[model samples]
Target chain A: MQGTVSVLTQIKEDAVATPVDRLVAATAPDMARVNELILSRAQSHVDMVPELARYLIDSGGKRLRPMLTVASAMLFGKGTGNAINFAAAVEFMHNATLLHDDVVDESDMRRGKPAARMIWGNKASILVGDFLLGQAFMMMVETGDIVSLGVLSSASAVMAEGEVLQLAKTGDVSTSPADYSEVIRAKTAVLFEAACQVGAISGGADTAGRQALSQYGLELGIAFQLVDDVLDYGGQAGTLGKNTGDDLREGKMTLPVILALAEGTAEERETITTALGDPDATADQVSAVVAIMNRYRALSRTLDQARVHARAAQRALEALPASDMQTLLADVVEYSVSRAY
Target chain B: MQGTVSVLTQIKEDAVATPVDRLVAATAPDMARVNELILSRAQSHVDMVPELARYLIDSGGKRLRPMLTVASAMLFGKGTGNAINFAAAVEFMHNATLLHDDVVDESDMRRGKPAARMIWGNKASILVGDFLLGQAFMMMVETGDIVSLGVLSSASAVMAEGEVLQLAKTGDVSTSPADYSEVIRAKTAVLFEAACQVGAISGGADTAGRQALSQYGLELGIAFQLVDDVLDYGGQAGTLGKNTGDDLREGKMTLPVILALAEGTAEERETITTALGDPDATADQVSAVVAIMNRYRALSRTLDQARVHARAAQRALEALPASDMQTLLADVVEYSVSRAY
Candidate 1:
């Protein structure tokens, strides 16, 4: 436990200019074009469509998914411009899911601001999310890359299924670790996998290169989500832009909760079960649950699991030729897990 | 006024077996294959997806859009099986929108049954709708017909815009006839146009043939929605599946409401404003609004407009080679308007 804590502290203390910052700088030009495309495509003749779409789009998400797409494309020496469309499309898909997920979860804050559904009403949110998806496909079609479209479209379906499965499992205290993995894979990691794969395809990756990037993406996505689950229980509100313990309040069966539930005594289990899915649960109640999670080392265990995936993500890159982009990509994967500390 | 009433009565009395029944019989074999594809495509590893999708798909909505797709493909006399995929994709798109629309409108009844949202909850409905849409795109991608995919994706964006525009205009009595036309064209007719256009393209239609079929579909779709709008105010609940005045209760600015609001006296306008969007409005309140609509000939005028578009649809078919399908299709258009009587 001391070793694990020291490793996390070392990673945090050593970071001044993080890999994400470097990656963002490395991919700024391509991302500029991607950003332009996203804003341009979000425009609609209906005033409310753009209004709601921009409200969410311009909100400060890390834009990590599209950045991954751009970075992956850059890793390949072949400079195909089609990655621009693919990257924008991937971001649109992510935003579309976020809009719908917020509505489904009845969440209030996104990126430290009121959610799109909260501002525009669920009807507008649903419609604009739909419009963005349609535009995403339209942009994909315009690129004439049927293979990339297939990857993304299939990912879109899997993501929705993941959300449905998550909804079904919400508040189910008996939800297993396996169920949580399946939920996050479907809802989160699949898009990440698709984004990287599509980027590799656009950059003229061979079958092996595509497969390598896809594996990297899948592992990185898992690590990213595991860390997110940890943050939902352990991170600060200022950094998260969302309140801590949101997963517990929403009854999301994330890794930490699943771990704690599995190890908790009967009394600790009672403490969690009472607060789980209780929208009005007090801050003190949430802290009590978090304390129980600490008692079981659930949060740290989840981070340990994240580190495993992050290492796997780094290993995926070893299959490719060594390049500066590859090293940065590896660092980005490490940063994804480390930042949660 | 007397002549208009007699014409409506004569059309009603002359109809024994409607043209829709004949059209359905004509397309039964193609429709069988489409139904099979739709059912198979709706399947998912996620149990709730199929459950909710099947509930809506199996509901009795006449499957008119897909039927049109099949019938249009048959008109070209080249039997390309790709139409089967396009037809199924079209229906999936239609069903997806219906799911989202029900959530947006907070609709209680759909096809004379409880809405999918009511049974499955809004979260499930929204996610399942998204899953259906993704499946729809996957089906289109499977066909490798980028042209058809382009058509459907663009129509999807347009339809969403239409829905948002209509939502914005809801309960706003100042909404104009032009606004009503734009709303229905975007929300309803665009899909109709795409269904036929894709079918014609798949059937090896020449440029002229494709344009003709596209025009025919657009006009027919306009007529279809106009008749539907009138039915929401003037048709019987038993025949319409949904209740008469559902549009009114939902604050929809359909043609009848637009026309009546435009022409009604101040007192009559007051009567409508009170009941419009009042979910708890009694049948008596609805009847009073219907009576006002009659006094202004709003419903009749709307039907007259539908007749004009229905005739234009038949004219568009004149550009094609004469065949049995053409004649039946023409009768189908006539029946679309006359059935409302």
Candidate 2:
């Protein structure tokens, strides 16, 4: 793991560009180990295990959640041995949810490629998801920190509950912004919160430091997901690696849709109701919904909400001593919301 | 937990009928608490969670795994206030696997009722299964015994790999007997083994005592699953709560089918192949497959193998001191095999 970290650090020294890139470079020394552990733990004697796991794990995602864990650990400048395990565990949990989510959503592609479930059947996807989750818990248990284990395990249960709640609300135009907050909190933010909190614990952070990082992660995750929800309607399909308006087509009651429904005219509401959850909805239909969102300023309002979260995430860092890592974490939050622009 | 135990014991003194009943009665003093914990921990704020989870948890399986944990703990006459949690954790793991297994296998019914996936759909089934698993780990973490947590967590990973390996082998005639052994040892026995081992540890048993109970549970679980495979072709559909020969229809390479294929003539092999994994195979086709199995004494041989495992389970008990719980556990192994008779 240490070797993996140093090699990545060498690369980073040559190329420290974006805020996230800078964060990655800053934590490269720890993240290299986390990356190596993630790959090693994903292996199994069963051939399909690695085959399906690598299809998703190797697919290029930002590895942002694990990056938060590693960064949060390093923020305290204390070298506890458990941070790598926690970071890997967080990645496994994220990937596992993705695997099962694809199956649940009947999604054909993820990360600009066919989903693992698309290549392997749903059975393999579900089983491999279970395998990843099991591995996640195994990693946590190895940490031998019962408090941290409880945090991760509890986050896992909340994530599932959040998913189920979102599933139940699918296609329901009456979903409120409050309900949407609960959904994102459960499904997305809890994991981010857990990743940071556990990393803080591993880093030998005091109680105030742990709480601060937890708040930062929670607010950042909410902002991240909010922007993602907006991107589905406003961004280019290629940029998101999915067609624009996928959330609308999938009946996902994200904040943009909820805001539009609450504020739109009856005619606009009828337009959304006609297209929402319609798998066969055409590009013209998606355009119609976006136009309604534009008329009501719902898209901008959603972005406004994301900026609010991003700022809250930045404010969370005020609990820590001023440091370059803290400034970078705050900058990353700004960068996250800036994507909507 | 102690209060719940005493209440069940008060009732058990009047009822000790069947072998499992005797085992349950002997362990009822502790198992009552495990049962309460199972129900309470399975609950969730997400309405769909408790609803789907209880649908399976309440479906009236014997709760054999938790009972084993309780019984193993009792065998040493020690209570560290952890067995109840471990027992509940074991049951959660068992039910979680069943929920996911039903989805993977596309099974329609379980425990003589509609499978959870059948009623809740695969999405809910997959998510709820994850929720239960998360809760299982949470329960273990509450015990604060990191060693036992590692034991259960590792076993969880192995069980998932086992399931995937079995799924990979489905419909493939080339699956070796050694491969089959690996599958059951992982998917089925490892949890039983972990349950007993953790219980012994929590019960203050020494390393030797823990190993004894682990071996006992392992062999017992192997015998139990072997009998189940045999019953899939031979037992009444009503008794098994599914169709006879479901394994053959699903192309599962159970012991009888593997043995028959290894020993059958080309013509017989052709007949078996026609029906294997044929979802629409008629009773006559199943009968033909059974006739081939009978001619080769495959079913009898499988039963003989189960008896060997059962005896081995009993022998494992000799490592511990003589006690009524030990005697009941030994008898329970015999009873598990007697179901096939």
Candidate 3:
């Protein structure tokens, strides 16, 4: 219990250190625009088709992806509708991803409720996700920014390829960190980079500025995902949502677990690897793996790496002109590391 | 045998007759631009995700949506990258729809090949489709046509809602023809409308030209879809890849099926209504339903309606100045009616 407390304490510190909150705060204008777009655009959908889509749109999510998009755009300097569209587009894309992810994961639960796949069925979830994706694309097209469109499209393609690669690699225990990064980059970070890059381009940043924001987003996305994975084992009841160590029970090879398997004692490694091999591993087995991970301080090591990436992400923002947007964008970096679960 | 030959002869005549061939020829220039955009815009995706995305894209498709976009643009006397992007965007949207459609239908098939969901698993298929959707939004953003983007996004939302509506109404015998048309418009025609609307906007068409092309697409899309339903029952095997009565097997309610359900004899209606309820109904039941539809001359009625829509679509073309592209677009209207299964 003491050990878990220390881990949680450390996460909170890292998350509030600097960049994240500022970045988030600086995106105020974009946020307002996003609210307008969400209300107006979603209401328009309700007008045309009514009810069904509104249910999915209104379903609760933190709207993290869209915020990231707007923040990234603002950090580039000024603001525009392209960023607004990017924000909404990213959010729509994220939601579409979630709907499909729930189906693919065959996860019956998400947050504290039954997954959309469970309530709506895999078929409805999948098709509705497709429709949302179509909506996302259409939003992007309306932005009329070729560079922005090009980057996002390429990101999307990479994201899908990465997803397919991960699917092909599922249930395999021999996956490497490099492979995992490649997969996550496509699955999670491309959009992050696209959001930032789109923002930078719209802000009239030079090539260097765009590249820096893109780098920041890429690294931050990886760090965010790493922290999220770590939370699967390390989080408390509230933050973790479902069961602690749920990812292991599902035979997921997340960072700490993977690192622990590499560094743990022979017996510990065997048990952990065995659980990964067994798709039907119980919660006890997952918890056992979690304990072993803690013993090796694998979670700490993973956190250390995430912090390093987060710092790098923060540093990338140094190139941007100092402004309220820049400060808020920077603060977001800190906040990103703070969510333990 | 005589009846089959006569039908085959009619199919041959349909293929040869009307404006589709001429339309394809006229739209060649803009379509060429569409091809260029595919190579350039989808360059990164095709390069990075070639292995994953090539499978579906290379699969046989008519490229009709893209043609609508290019044709609409050319009709307005503006041949620019906007039209090309719009064309590519529509194609991307169309493919995304098909990917999800196969997943929802659970048929494990598409155009005779194993469905993406079947071959790659639902997870990969679903995610990749999403990636394409993002790619499309990115394309729209790059185009910098806010109005067109709005149109595309709106269509995307409507399309999703349409699918959800269909899902909700599936296997329910009381689904009205109006509701069925709603589904067709949302799921299919919206893309067509966007394709043409984008084309006109990108091609520098005046407001009048844009409105005309938009109307043309709306009508053409409806006509095309109506004709498609008719072909599902009576189209030649050589052209329409799937077996006849597939829609009936799936319990879908297209216009012919809906009209037949409305007009058929009590006994005939009961047989179809029963088959619609039983998802596992036998091949013989499917055949029986088709026979009942034939007895009701449902396809004839549907064909007549399609012709009317085709003429209406052609009327929209009259706003365009005389050009090969305009003529070809008009040709597409006639071709839509005559397209075999």
Candidate 4:
């Protein structure tokens, strides 16, 4: 009983220490180069390209994706400078999607500020997103590694497909868990998979190590998104960097909504459908939906789902030769799910 | 007098022959492969990809850029098979821009059909445009020519910069002719230049031949856009596949508008500005603007500028060896400007 309590206390202590912090500290040297490359590449002879790009790039997001790329590269202890390029490319791709997503979703705010679209208008947002995408490909090509280029490019296409699929399923109550899985995989996990895989490639990881990192990224990304979906209904707005229930207001068919709808009673379904996609849904209605979700443990179930993937992510890391970087990556996966708890 | 009349008649007959038509006929065999590649590459496991893609790709915009790529490749007759891929990538880039352009312009029609956004909504249009861009890069990477990839990627960045610049300058009457030149060059000419350059690279053109084709494409693109600017004010909807005076209504600062603004009286400038970017500007207002433009010979002046570029395009080909394709290309430049006459 004493051992169990001590282990639980240790886990709680570790949870407070974010995996991203460790990842950042470990990869800080390369990440500085990545930041420089990102800023330099985002620039253009045309002033607006850099201005709108900097708005999103400098928004102070954790830069988690690029950190993953840099950390994955560090795992092999290979000093190929290509990781800096891949990290920049990954960051650019993520920012491009955010800019475009804000426009498509008519999102007024991102990262707790007026979106690029809100400041520059939708046309500028769309075009600047294209600029970042162009820059990303340019950086990848500069590495002169066609194989990594192929991986990133293919991920780019799949990410678009995933977004379109989600757009297609928006507001439809019949969206299956399987469909939700596909959406999250495409929209989130694929980039993570590509980011780490490209980093591994740049780091001179052999086929096995590359595949292992790819799996780790994929599972971690899935957990990350599942937790995001849960947080939308249950997390504080400050914690989320946006409104608490943006997914609900956007009519996004996230895992929490999917699972809740599957298990809710008819009256509870009515409560959710009434509020789902209602950009004007009141706080009272949100509270009511949360009540139902709690009664059915839907939020907990979503977190449970995230935990499964988080564990899988850690398992994938076991395939790599054990290192401090590997241990830190595994802990980050746990912290991803712990955000909900 | 008889000789002069005979020569004039011959020039008139040659002016009726379009360069695009000649190039199209010459490159018909290779273009079939390119068309096949375009159709195949546009497919996705996601159903919306093909539906939205085909809506714009099949709208019949002459596919002129892809034709330039194929014709440039055939200049060397090397048959490296990279031309088909380059041609498809060029076409995809063009179509992707058109999709996003329709959304940005809030255009109601394209190729005499309701815009894809009208049929599928803004969200679909934005996402599908992204898919096509992703597919374009995928095809470029598949060619395994990093040099050509760099060319297309840089062009992609410049094109987006141009569009954003245009967006920033939209509805601003003070936009300079120099600024207008930069906009058109970045927005339109860079793709044409990249398309032809990539084709030359793939076709194994000598340095002189490659530079010749690059110059030829850049000049030809400038001429093509100048003619388009003229046609926007003067051509019938049948020829334009869009309403005349769209530039004025959209507040676009095309050459005719810029020249007219430069030379017109204060009242004339006021008359143009009243209708400029006025979505409700009527046919009478359009006619009034055209009257002022004609009074100053702005339309004629615009066409003259186009002719300079067209002739320069032909001059660029003089650096290359004389071939049937070369003569046809020169004739096409003449035809490009002759449309106004």
lDDT of 2 by residue, B1-341 (tens): 35434544564465546678776666665677787888899887779999999989889599999888887887785433798999999999999999999998889989889999889999999999999999998899998999999999999999999999999999888988899889989999999899999988888898899999999989998988889898998742213233888999999988889999999999999999999999889988888888888889888888898999999999999877886667778878998998987
lDDT of each: 0.87, 0.86, 0.71, 0.84
DockQ of prediction 3? 0.41
Please give each candidate's TM-score.
Answer: 0.94, 0.95, 0.82, 0.93
Q: State the displacement of the C-alpha of residue A157, model 3, in Å, after optimal TM-score superposition.
A: 3.9
lDDT of 3: 0.71
Q: Which CAPRI tier for candidate 2?
A: high
User: What does candidate 2 score on TM?
Assistant: 0.95
Question: Which rank order by DockQ, best down to worst?
Answer: 2, 1, 4, 3
What digit string (tens of lDDT, one per residue) describes model 3 on residues A305-324? Answer: 77888898889988767755
Stretches > 4 Å off in candidate 3: A1-33, A44-61, A68-86, A134-155, A194-214, A235-242, A249-251, A261-274, A277-279, A319-332, B1-49, B73-82, B139-147, B201-204, B235-242, B323-325
Docking class of 3: acceptable
**Where does candidate 4 stray beyond 4 Å?**
A1-17, A235-242, B1-17, B78-80, B235-242
Q: Write the per-residue lDDT of candidate 4 for residues A219-338, one digit (tens) a residue.
A: 999999988888888642223333766888889988777877899989999999999999998777777777777777778888888888988888888977876677777888887787
lDDT of 4 at A105: 91
What is the full ranking by TM-score, best candidate first?
2, 1, 4, 3
DockQ winner between 1 and 4, please give it. Answer: 1
Model 4: which residue pairs collide? Answer: B19-B332
- List model 2 lDDT by residue over A1-341, tens digit each: 35434644555466446678777777776777888898899899999999889889999499999988888887885434899999999999999999999999999889999999888999999999999999999999888899999999999989999999999899988888998999999999999999999988999899999999999999999988988888888742213234887888899999888988888889889999999998888888888888878878888888888889899999989979987678778988998887877
Cα RMSDs of all predictions?
A: 6.6, 3.2, 7.5, 5.9
Cα lDDT tens digits for candidate 3, B23-113: 4555566677776666454444323244445677777376878877776665555555787787888887777778778778877677778
Candidate 2 lDDT: 0.86
